[model samples]
Target: MEFKNAKEARQKIREGMWTKPTPGLAYGYTQANLVVLPYKYALDFFIFCQRNTKPCPILDVCEPGKYTPIVTAPTGDIRSDIPKYRIYKNGNLVEEVTDIKKYWSEDLVSFLLGCSFTFEKALEDANIPIRHIEENKNVPMYITNIECKPAGMFNGPMVVSMRPMPKDLVQKAIDVTSRFPQVHGAPIHYGDPKKIGIEDINKPDFGDSVTIKEGEVPVFWACGVTPQAAIMRVKPDFVITHSPGHMFITDIKENDLALF
Candidate 1:
């Protein structure tokens, strides 16, 4: 079935018919990274995200035990709408499941973070080629040396996603993506993967690598998956998040999240 936007994509997930990564499905709607934690840690984690806004941009947060993120999406159930959710117990991923109906709890607090996919369509519209999308590969992501500000139990290196494009088009992509600050806006750095502690440009810590042509430059941007990096270090008793690439599609439009 062909869905028009993220909202529709979310509806399809709610129906249990869609079970793929949410990248090309809702082309223009702003998708978000998911994080669910016990309410005891919500204040600290929310403070962490607020302190490190670039990599962990906040979209909306659901109160304890509530699946709905009232600020951004209306009455949306976080427990069931996403294609996949990763469950962690004491910092170890215990299960990768489609729905968390059995795990839902009043003590859990849901958080929605801005995603980089929300800006890829804009980059595509500007005639800038996104090599990962063309090759049907997951965007390459890395853990950088830069450390994010710690709040209580949260602290880790900044995670970045990379895309290769022509040298001339790099600036165009920068200008295009900079407008969507809500969804990880702007390039943190371009070229020289080693400069950011990335030893192998061809192998990413997360996601698959794509071809880098003779004339293309590897452009890196802060990724929303950063929270996953935090999960390992924070070592909370329980955590629930969307699996890599399988994001929570939202009701918001891509253009709606862009800056004027």
Candidate 2:
């Protein structure tokens, strides 16, 4: 299920042709995390993202009642562009669907947040293996003890995605990813997941665990899913988000986001 470009990939997803995780598709293009909330909570969530840029770098924010991410993927519909979506009501997950058109409303605001997946092409180019991708599984994610800077009613433990790479490539991976700060920059921690309150590296709070090969260390990065943690804690009345590992592919090229 390879595609020529981001648009094609998005179309496939839009038409229900692809429902799996989006990692290996649309290579070299930027991918994003989705967060749709009511107009009332939009401001608070935006502030939360501003105060916690590492885990919630915003790529584009649609106007209230809008679904198009004009800046990143103008032709795309946030309601169906993502392969999968999660619906939450009063903090409880109510359903997982392929599209949210039925849930659309004028009071809803959609946000496209920078995703670590955006930098994976840079990582692959550097020859640093992405373990979960290699294993055909979702990247392992954990909710850390580190609390994000509180903003309004939004605050919770930071969530991080892990990629197990050889000990030797750790520095190289950091150097490569550091150039793309808009997509979570670089590895925040490596070697010990316990230091971040992960009691079991084999069991992640979100996504799937992968093989941490011999001589490989688990590298962690700030994840956009951090907002979901806050949503659950705050128990907002209604919200929608892309399922973990499933992302919205954007028209922007991956290299375009690099600081270098």
Model 2 lDDT per residue over 1-260, tens place: 89999999999999999999988789999999999999999999999999999999999999999999999998999999899999999998999999999999999999999999989988998899988888999888999999999998899999999998899999999999999888899979998888999999999999998998888899999999999999899999999999999999999999999999
lDDT of 1 by residue, 125-229 (tens): 898888777887778889888789999988988999998999999888889989988888998999998999899998888888789999888999988888888
Determine which window of 10 residues in candidate 1 has minimal summed lDDT.
Answer: 1-10
The model with the greatest lDDT is 2
Q: Rate the local accuracy (lDDT) of all candidates.
A: 0.86, 0.93
> Which pairs clash (backbone N, Cα, C closer than 3 Å) in model 2?
none
The reply for model 2, stretches above 4 Å from the true place, is none
